[model samples]
Target: MLLRKPAASELSAEPILSAAENYSGEMHAIDTGVRVDAVEFARGRVALGRLLAKRGIGYGDRVVMAVANGPLFAAALCAVLARGASPLILHAKTPAAEMRRYAERYAARMVFGDGSSETEYRETGLEPYLVEAADWARLLCANVKIVDESAGNVSLVLPGVPLHPTSGTTGQPKVALRPGRPAIAEAAHYIETTGIQASDTILVAAPQSHAYCYGMGTMVPLLCGASIITMRGFEAGLVQSALRDTNVTVVPAVPAMLGSLMFGTRGDLFARVNTVFSAGAPLNEKTAKAFANKFGIAVRPLYGTTETGGIAISLPGSQAVAGICVGPAMKDVEVDVRDDGQGLAPGLGMTYVRSESMMTGYLDENGLDQSFVVDGWFKTGDIANQDTEGRIYLHGRQSEVINVAGMKVIPSEVENVLLRISGVIEAKVYSREHRTGSQSVQAAVVAHGVDDADVRAHCEKNLVYYKRPSMISFVEALPRNATGKIDMAALSNL
Candidate 1:
């Protein structure tokens, strides 16, 4: 059966009540051993909204939410949205200094978290509303008055509000502000592209604070009336158990985490999942092929950023396309491949997206304005090539591209080549400043029983002379950030 396209009107409607009415009888979430119904979730959100309003939280207020993915987190997001406030969903595991910095950067007026987080925030000299899991039910149920179900004035503030942080592999994370409608549209597009349905169950192992989880993991399922089973963190064992125990049909994961699941001790446990969405970083061909061979399910590669909601381009399982192609631009989203340096079109340059999911902008005391775009399109900063058939293939971040003697090389190309090596477990390639004056190609590899000579020989077969790594360092493991992406800054220091 063909999945119907989501109505634009529904996309513009309030996300809080949309899932409630659509999936009223369906189970909405499974956190640990607790199962929450859609109706109960909606009521909780309403009550929480009222409670927050009473605490002086109002429309356009920035609420820094440092929490994990669970019933309380979902309720908090809904409550904030209901109260016409925007949620800056911070990673619960983020260092306190970074969290405090973000709160200060965004000029956040209110903060919400558990007792421990609240204590940490207080230590940082910010007095925030502290709500624990035990009291969340009571707090949300305290004020049960009917409030405006309309998306409220907070949605209007979205066009200029920086609400979330963009993960930076090479530098400090930046805040990306997305208007409410764009977020809703992105969620709607995700549902349409993936054919999400009320009967489908989504397993969210990714961090909800990130765009991938915010859209595919949380928003998409809720908007489409599908249930969500959220795991607080990514664990191969926990993921396997969820897949086998729950009716989890859809999963969104980063390539590294997916690689661990496919090649780790729990490799064979993902056979029950019907569809898998891989994103956050470049998805290599080996992992893609291995996942399909092992699970009889296609690993759908998606491309997008915090600046552009969940998926800008994606391929469905029904599609025969495979490997690192991100399929096509989603409906209501436009992708352009521009010329390098010039930023003009028809060459392998930077990718630009014009979509409903475009962020408002990065925030500052001067307020949000033109920081991410030239005209109407958001500069993706990702280097990609669009084929004649309109399929997008991401190479690597334009900023991370290695320039060896004026020759440009994408790290993903080198990384893919190294992964093909016999004993290589994982590989990352970057550019390092040489004492001789120019930047040289460097590679850090994680392998078992493989030496630098073996990796160089492997690279020799795949990469050109200038593209090969001049310096190769073998590490036990690559340093990754909270979101499981390679920490290039840390690598540079090494």
Candidate 2:
């Protein structure tokens, strides 16, 4: 009698780890490289896995991770997968209050990060692990006893949590929990569609917690057996050095990072780069062309969201023609641009996509809100149009998603914090478009005692730097429309 071996569930990281083991490439960081072959990857996985196991982080337990984007963070991610546990990865500099709230919300078994972050987590009265990314890299290098593997050679489990968070009108963060683990197929599609090579070295220049960075930095490279060069944050000096020193094949960068490279540094930055993908926000076509002219590699626009996965990528070797062309829908993905038949041919309207990687829906106090997803199509709240050539041209977003150098900031989220300050009766935030084609956060506040400086200081303590209001107008009262609703246009004009 012939029998089939047990298979991992749909959402586990095992598939990628297993495939990664077949390739001999190491995961390189600013410090050094760690071999990713099956045996070596297993060693690191087991060492960390044993540590987590000792801490009572076993199968199905949830762990919260607040670490910088680097080798140690990557190793912790591997450890989470090895122990069959769910992880909620946050920015290394996430505020202590925010980190504690997330840990409580997710019911995390333990928290992990560097010593400094651990101190923050400790203030929450929760169990936290203080581990360094460099130390994990070293541990992966040392000879260690292999812990017994999980029950299956490939075990997939969906975390159903957030490494990225979006917000609602109420200013509360909402996480989309996709049901199944189709990550293997999703990652494969990304690898194949992006033309990833086994010999390639990928550079992740964004925060590892961001969706784009996590997918490009962690998933795609791991599955393809490609070396990954990561940074804790967007450091221009570190990025320039990595590109100059390493034959960096692909760079997944936001527009701001590329902008710095354009004006601050030049020459041979693109000598070895196979592809450079600009996502999170739009890139200036003029600067893009100038860089392409100098480097021989065109800056390609990429479009995706925390909910939509990666929707489109600029076709390799293709230059922008007219509007912002985010190439075409990736493999195994279908995009249907709906305009209510407004007679706008290839009209600008809401974008919808059906893909294996689309998130199930938003999760919050309201439970899962799949209203955004009708049938199998997920509504990507961005306004876009597609030409006959199947290229996607993005216009703007449905909501005020301030793109401060590719860091997404929801206006209501900042406004909520603004309202919390003493004497702040009303608050409205908006995005101001810059000459460089990117956007910055700005706000108009109606308060009694707070000055512009006070408002800025409040935001500094409450929100991330990108989310803080760069320009603030302390108005006596905000203008309202006929319906008694705050006129966003008038606020923007202010």
Per-residue lDDT of model 2, residues 259-342, tens digit only? 567756667777888888887665545547667887788888877776767778889877754126788888988998888543
Best by lDDT: 1
What's the lDDT for candidate 1? 0.68
- Model 1 regions lying over 4 Å from their true place: 1-31, 115-119, 126-129, 132-162, 167-172, 263-271, 311-314, 317-323, 341-347, 435-437
In model 2, the runs with Cα more than 4 Å from the true position are 1-8, 20-23, 31-40, 115-118, 126-134, 137-163, 168-172, 178-180, 321-323, 340-346, 366-371, 401-494
Compose the digit string of candidate 1's lDDT tens values, residues 1-494: 11222233322326444553465424333445666777677766677777778777776566677677766666777777666666777886764545556555555556665424545555666554433333334321111111322322222344113277765333456666665567767888887776877788888888887878887776676677778887667888777778767778888888878787875545455656667888877676766777777777778888778877754556556234344578888887888888757432246777788887776556544444454565668777777788887888777787887777777777877887888887787788999987886889888988898998888888788888988999999898888877877888899987
Q: lDDT (CA) for every model shown?
A: 0.68, 0.65
Give each prediction's root-mean-square deviation over alpha carbons.
6.8, 12.3
The worst-scoring run of ten residues by lDDT in candidate 1 lies at 139-148
Shift of residue 264 alpha carbon in model 1, Å: 6.3
* Residue 39 accuracy (lDDT) in model 1: 62
